[model samples]
Target: MNKDQVKGVGEQIKGKVNEALGKATHNPGKELKGDLQQAAGKVQKAYGDAKENAKDNVKRNAR
Candidate 1:
C-alpha cells in the first residue's frame, strides 16, 4: 500500500488502542480524542483508496 494508506491504517489502530485505554480508565476526553483520530484515519484511507482507483482507471483507459 501507499504511504497514505499505511499511515491511515496505523492511525486507525492507534486510535482504537487509545479508545480502549480510555474506556478502561474511564477517561471521556481521551475517548473523544480517539474517536476523532479514528474518523480522520478513515477519511485519509478513503482518500488513498480513491487515489489508487483513479490511477487504475487511468491505466486501464490508456490500455
Candidate 2:
C-alpha cells in the first residue's frame, strides 16, 4: 500500500462519517460534501492502485 492508497482510504472513511453525521443532523450541504469527498477518495485510490500495478509490471518486464 502506497501513500495515496492509504490517504484515499482515510478520506473515504472520513467521508462516510461526515455523511452519516449530516444525515443524522439533517444537513444536506454536509451530506453532499461527503459524497463528493468519497468520490474523490475513490479516484485517488484507483490512481494509487494503477501506479502500483505499473511499477510491478515494469519490474517483471525488466527481469
Candidate 3:
C-alpha cells in the first residue's frame, strides 16, 4: 500500500482507540475528535487506493 494508505490505516486504528478511551472516560469532545480523525483517515485511505489504481492502469496501458 502507499504511504497515505498505511498512514491512514494507522490513524484510523489510533482514532478508534482514542474514541474508546474517550467513551471510557466520559469525554464527549475527545470522542468527537476521534470520530473526525477516523473519517479523515478513511478519506486518505480512499485517496491512496484511487491513486494506486490509476497508477496500475497507466502501467497496464503502457504495456
Q: Highest TM-score among the candidates is held by which one?
A: 2
Residue 62: error of model 2 in Å? 1.1
Candidate 2 — which residues are off by over 4 angstroms? Answer: none
Better of 1 and 2 by TM-score: 2
Estimate the TM-score for candidate 2: 0.96
Tens-digit per-residue lDDT, 1-63, candidate 1 = 677788888889889988998999999988988898899899888888888888899999998
Separately for all candidates shown, the number of backbone clashes (residues 3 or more apart, or on different chains) is 0, 0, 0
Which 10-residue span in candidate 2 carries the lowest summed lDDT? 5-14
Cα lDDT tens digits, model 2, 3-25, are 99988898898899889989999
Winner on lDDT between 1 and 2 is 2
* Cα lDDT of model 3 by residue, 1-63, tens digit: 899999899889988988998999999988988898899899999999999999999999998
lDDT of 2: 0.91
Off by over 4 Å in 3: none
